[model samples]
Target: MNQPEILQLFRVEEKRSKSSLRQLFAVVWAQLKMMLAYKSWLVMDLLSTLASVVMYYFVGLQVDPHQLSRSGWGTSYLAFSLVGVATSNYLWACLTRLSHSIQHEIRGGTLETIAVTPINMLMFFIGLTARGYLVSLIYLVGVFTVGVYGLGAKLSFTPQSLFVFIILFVLMLVSNQALGLVAAGIIMVYKRGDPLVFILAAVNEFLAGVLYPLELLKRFPALQVLSMLFPYTYALDGMRRVLILGASVFDVNVLTDILVLGVFSMLLVPLGLKMLGWGYDRIRREGTTSSY
Candidate 1:
């Protein structure tokens, strides 16, 4: 190539090197250093997760097979609970991780320092939790594998089912992450966050039917109505239909679940980002951005 062409190529490559995505990846790598610092964490996490799966499997044995079919879900309570255990990690990965990241900055008195950087704080905050979400995705796949191979939990793997699942999974990430941004914002302002996060995570899992069928909520009309308010309710229900029942995208129930989840993602994501920005500003104004 000519000298001019080589210099132009260099310039283009330099610009691309500084692109937002590359910056985000750089930040993710940095965040991973902290996450991987505790070398045994992954092992402990795997062991605990396996123990929980085994425990729930035995629990499923005690549940009458008729009870699941009567509820209009699948016949295997083991399969049902395994799905719940797998998908429910998203709640913590999304909500708790973001909040904890903010608090970590606060505890270290670096929140304000980082906030002042030319870096995009909003994107940076989201990037900080990227590793956690990635880890959660791994767990989700791991549990699904364990369910299929280790425990013989029946799951549908047809193209139609997987397509619907991929769509719902994206919607679930976006919709559920909306509240996580808001929770991180709350932590930014309060310097305390886990109590609120804990309450929401617990209640969200329960309302979303993470461990039980939504049919049980029929007994509590008020709670049934409340359950419909969370995006994860639609997500979990849709996921179950596709994964456990091998439902098609054309199925009315699956369509509704995907539709509702998409709507939730559209409405909540922007609102959550706005709330996070608001909280970040509030802390700065109060001179408490780095105070824990």
Candidate 2:
């Protein structure tokens, strides 16, 4: 192609990209506005986050810091626990909380309206994920602060490490959101909302290494294998490597974890989308947009 022609094509592509981004931001903004409408619920969510920090603080006091640090962690017990707590809260927000939004719509018979919207379903779903991300960030900040002031843990502050940490954290978020989408698919098909959430929460409590190392599960090979598949397991460990252990991405086992999370997100997102579409079609065929 001639230079002029190529330039024109580039201009057109840029404009389209800008327009797509604008639309995505608009959708995200609308979802945030809807979330804000539930002011009391938002406050309660914040309080719950703060409560987690307080609970962890007291629990830390009961454990001997020397014993926790003696286990070759290099950091104080509070520092180690804070990373686990923050990442765990993010996992809960992304997976357990976000999974229920679509189910609520289905139960209220409003999911049909969503299917009819011209907005891209993928964009809409991801936009909704921002609410959970923001809520999780609130909790992370609270717990992290508690680790610093309430528990007297020193943080290693380096710009490069911070950037790498945030990137990995966001990738972990995407992976959890993908799992949430899968949970949403089950809700779409079976209309059963609470079971997956409960099961996942219980499993994470023991297996995600929130309070202990995964090596502690050696006696339970089946549980160990299952826990290895959870994105939160890697995320919690990676966060500790960055935030507490002062390890760079090159020094840490981040690549393997990132690869696993990437694969999960790439595979499950499409499957979940297809399943949700099928559920929407079924409801439309029955003319039950607003019917439970």
Candidate 3:
């Protein structure tokens, strides 16, 4: 190719890469700024974490912490519950934003502005999501650190377990996005989404073997299979196995978890984008795009 043509192509590629990076960071930074603006809300959020920890401690006193220890689950209930908290937060961040975010922006007149932007719509949505997702992750880290140091609980910071944990963490994010995409679709079409947001959140927290063992779901085969498909199930279990149980990366069902999460991500992205596009088209055709 000619020098001018080659230079033009390079410029185009470079711009695309820059735009992608910018979108990613922009979404995360915007959420952080918004969170910062509400100092009281942040305080409340932190306090809520503390409150949960206290409640857990009180209940731990009532029950035997060694119960899980005997089951070969983990060393302590605190270790078990902290991992649950982290995974649950990640799922909540992804699903909550997916279902309500666009509707929220649309009602606030922000959607109109976002729709007019020159960037790719999917990229923009992802950027917007990255904002809250990162904040939630930061909150999770704070909770974990406090649980480890403040409580003086045993936590593994081993390189091998850390590697496995990172892999599961990413898988968890992707699976969370799948649920988010479905919620976004419902919001776009129905104006009000299905009441599954709260239900899903509850399940992620209570059922997905987050605070307890998957064996608890054994009697309910359907529930077991359903929870098995959930990324939170693998994530909470994997975290406990690695960080508390001192298990190796090769010791857990890492492969199966990754496969399920990968499949969910592959399906959700295109579905979400299509849903958003369809919602936009429906609004345009019906001339209801502007009406909140």
Give lDDT per model, in order: 0.85, 0.71, 0.72
- Top candidate by lDDT: 1
lDDT by residue for model 1 over 1-292, one digit each (tens)? 9999988986783333446676688779888887689769887887777777888888988998898899987789888888789988987788788888788878887777877766777668878888788778778878887778899989888888888989998898898889998888887887767899888988999998988899999999999999999888898999899989888999899999999998998999998999899998898899888677
Ten contiguous residues with the weakest lDDT in model 1:
13-22
Predictions: Cα RMSD each: 6.1, 8.8, 7.2
For residues 130-233, could you state the per-residue lDDT of candidate 2 as single tens digits?
A: 77777777778877776687667777658977876887788787777667766765565566666877688668756988877566677899999999878778
Q: Estimate candidate 3's RMSD in Å.
A: 7.2
- Candidate 3, residues 74-110, lDDT tens digits: the string is 5577767777776677788788775577777778877
Q: Show pairs that collide, candidate 2.
A: none
Clashes of each: 0, 0, 2
Question: What's each prediction's TM-score?
Answer: 0.91, 0.81, 0.84
By lDDT: ranked, best first: 1, 3, 2
Q: Write the number of the candidate with greater TM-score, choosing between 2 and 3.
A: 3
